[model samples]
Target: MINGRDPRIDFFRGLALIFIFWDHVPGNPFAQLTVRNYGFSDAAEIFVFLAGYAAVLAYGRIALRDGFVVACVRILRRAWVLYVVHIFLLTLLMGIVFVANNHVETRDMIQEMGLSYFVRNPQQALADELLLRFKPNLTDPLPLYILLLLALPLILPWMLRRTEYVVGLSVALYLMVPLFGWNLSAYEGGVWYFNPVAWQLLFVLGGACAIRGQRPSAPQPRPLKQQPLFIVCATYVVISGLITLSWKWPGLHEMLIPKAISDLLYPISKTDLSPARLLHFLALAYCAAKLLPTGQAWLNNWPAQQTCRMGRYSLEVFCLSVLLAPLADMANALAGDTWPMQVFTALLGLGLMMLMASGLELNKRLGTPGRVVAV
Candidate 1:
């Protein structure tokens, strides 16, 4: 913990931001290195879960320091800020896509980024945008988060009082998604890219964990290696990694895998947070939580420090990444997607993200002067 706040949260959030940037750039060779290439759930899961975890911790601190009223106001205000950022970011992204498309020769940037609807039907697109349903590629997360935060005021009191009950309710709501086909509408006759109804379970679980940590009466987790659950989680993570990696070698994968299992797992929908994907992410989270000590020496190293900085200024870093992705794609495209350009652009993108983070840290310190900044 740094200043009574968990450094691991920021570290993992920052890592997820890097993965998200690499994953978004079309045809970027670094995409192969991202967690998505070898897992059922990717950076999106980390982003959402940690958003909840950090949000609840922050909210709890505020409620204790001020009151429930102040905490509610802060949460609502945050949702509003995210809403405004989403609007401006969408506008800026659309403009960037147009400019990038005009310059790039390899592919149509508009179609590639799924912005063709906005181009064809500007009026309807604007209407949908106002309603938070016209999100293009790379913009789904913020909108989902806005909805989740908006609902927090309604549930936060209950969550603070009885976290386990709230979590149980969240799980029930998640189950209702598949049964009732619950989802929010999207712009072009489709549902949301990240389904809020199904994804809220992770958000709530993250909050529950935060609440548990703050309660003095809550039981501490058992030593991981001594627990049977640790072995089960470790075994599942390894087996799933192998199964995911098998897709790279189609011939061997086809020969080794049974058709029955493949058929069952074929349509693991990220839209609705499929059970298989959810379970895999849970197992993965369990293993990570158990194995990675929070305050390891390596975590305080220079590289890790920079990542933690990025995590601290995640909103700014995330917006920068959304903008940088298109530019990275254009650079690689103009350079003919050579290995050198791929490596350069990938490294350069991360460097830029770190720079933005560092700048934000300096700004925050200058703004606060002697006041202690919350983690």
Candidate 2:
């Protein structure tokens, strides 16, 4: 059933998880290079973009083999798994806090499970870990992914059943991003750091792209030089240049740039799908795609395919990494600002994650669990 999985998607997803781990670890030698820390190039956009691509690729297969209904069911099932993982992580983090400080007040814990805590304090350090508030803590991505997964079924149906409607809807939604900012605060428990309601359009757009490739609107074949990859790269360059220019040239600000144009470069906060950020991410993705070797020889070689293994079991790896992140943070914190100790601790944390990933890969192949794989 899982025989035809693409190595490219799996490999990149593994890379994304690796970047995510480095980014989330409180203070590590690699944090600065991680997309999370960099202002210009954050991995959030890359992760979301690739997620869109992977969703379409996976759903394309399901839609063809199992029909739309089955695809929808599978998507929902996956989302449910994500939610279960989130709850487990939350409980574990709360336990960590309780164990670390036995005197942690009940009122604080109660506040964490509800909406009031987020409202009372935004960047409160205690709140970030205890409440699992989005953005303020790196652990927030899972909750956001869960929200996105909820919207996947809704968007995927139209994408598979009637693509033109999806196109018009996506365009309308993209345009409206400039007209009205999303009401992030309205989310019941706490807002998803990356609001998928707005981001769904992108993912669905990718699905549509994949669908088109599998079954074209017309039997026309363009030259190899005019491929989608090339177009994507060109578009990325133009968009990125425009964004950079907007930043460099102060005089351009006062010009009659459309509200949509202005919004692209300078995104409003709390919204995840800003056109500027989206384009920036796309550019980076294009570059990565180009650089990554697409050969299948190494992928097919059983013993030499560890990267594929890592990619194939990304969900488990991601869970382990997230679970261990706080401990990594605590270690870094204890190591203090000492450069040598911090470096050593960071390396130790990375080494542990690598071992976990390797062991998980081995266990998965052998059909036995030897030791826990903590990302």
RMSD of each: 3.0, 7.2
How would you encode candidate 2's per-residue C-alpha lDDT over 1-375 as one tens digit per residue? Answer: 212444676666666677777776645677656553433446555455556667767865786788878988888898888777766766566555444333333223223334344446634634453333443345556766666667777777666678889878877776665577553542235555666556766666655655654552443277434778767765666655554556556678446456776665565443556665665565665565555555676567643355455556666667677656656555555555466766676667656656677888776657765655566
The residue pairs in collision within model 1 are none
Give me candidate 1's TM-score against the actual structure.
0.94
* TM-score (all chains, Cα) for each model: 0.94, 0.70
What ranges in model 2 sit over 4 Å off? 1-4, 36-39, 97-136, 161-164, 184-190, 212-264, 267-270, 290-293, 297-307, 368-375
**What overall lDDT, based on C-alpha atoms, would model 2 receive against the true structure?**
0.60
Residue 321, model 2, lDDT: 72
Give the per-residue lDDT of model 1 (tens digit) for 1-375: 101567888999999999999999877788898887777888999999999989888987788778889999999999999999999999999999899999998899999898999889999999999999898999999999999999998888888887888898999999998899999989877999899999999999888777765545534467666789888988887777888898899987898779998898878889999987888888988888767775757596899999999999999999999999999999989999888998899899999999999998888777985777677
Candidate 1, residue 356: the lDDT equals 95
